[model samples]
Target: MADFDEPLCGCLQDMFSCLIVFCVPCGGICIQAYSVDKATSSGMVCPFLWSCCLGCIGSAVNRGQIRQKYHIEGSFIMDCLISCFCGCCAATQEYREVMNRERPK
Candidate 1:
């Protein structure tokens, strides 16, 4: 099972990210997806487009990528549901995970 530095309750754990996502969903999603993918600006376009136009698909894809990269214990369907229903929270959690991983260990 994949280990997470924090649980999925990013709203409770990360108020800043949660607030950002809540205020500007598209920008927040773009930043979170881009950061998690660890890619250049060109690569950020796809996720940014998807997130801006198709939130469900974008969030699901981003969550799936993060899960696979970290061997997180979750199914694609679950990721979809989370993305569909709890997008802000999910993205915030994913963002936190990426930030945590990037921090010095």
Candidate 2:
């Protein structure tokens, strides 16, 4: 059960993240999809295509992949539920995870 390094609400602490979460047509979600693409070794265009094609399911799959990579505790069902219900929040959390991990600590 790998724990998230940052709080889910950590995005709220960052101006850009806040914008991403609040932005109606989220560019943040795209950024997160790109991030996941890199992390999963998926094609650069895959996430974008998924976002355009599958919408919430794309981001949910991305989140599931990320969780798998990090050994985080979650299931696909949960990912779908979260992504379906709170996509912005889920994207914000995923974006924070990607950004925080990439930064030099």
Candidate 3:
């Protein structure tokens, strides 16, 4: 299985994502969720509410989804821990992974 496109600590490499995640984590998570699934983005209010109330759980789920989609090697427990302890970094790394992988060459 492949690993994450970028390391968790590599969050700093993408300054824009890092700044957004650091300053407005929920918004960053919303964007990441949207990028993964447009249908989810339509219900902006619901996601925003969830992000506010269950940010860690939401992020961990989202991280797992990303890992599944990209075939990245990781477990849900690790995702949970990363999302819980390094929320901003995890969000930033997720954002970068999606953007980097999905972007056209």
Top candidate by lDDT? 2
Per-candidate TM-scores read 0.80, 0.81, 0.79
Whichever of 2 and 3 has more lDDT, that candidate is: 2
The number of residue pairs in model 3 that clash at the backbone is 0
Worst 10 residues of 3 by lDDT: 38-47
Show model 1 residue runs off by greater than 4 Å: 39-42
**lDDT, model 2:** 0.73
Give a tens-digit lDDT track for model 3, residues 30-86.
Answer: 666664563233444554454567777777777777787788898988888987898
Q: Relative to the true structure, how large is the alpha-carbon lDDT of every model?
A: 0.72, 0.73, 0.72
Candidate 1 vs 3: which has more TM-score: 1
Order by TM-score, highest first: 2, 1, 3
CA shift at 85, candidate 3, in angstroms? 0.4
95: Cα error in model 1, Å = 0.4
Query: Per-residue lDDT tens digits of candidate 2, residues 1-105?
Result: 987676665667667767855875757567667668656778657776776678778777888888887778988788888878877667778777877676777
RMSD values, in order shown:
2.5, 2.1, 2.8
lDDT per residue for candidate 1 within 1-105, as digits (tens), equals 865666777466777777788787475786566656662223666766667777787778777777777777888788889888877778788888877776678
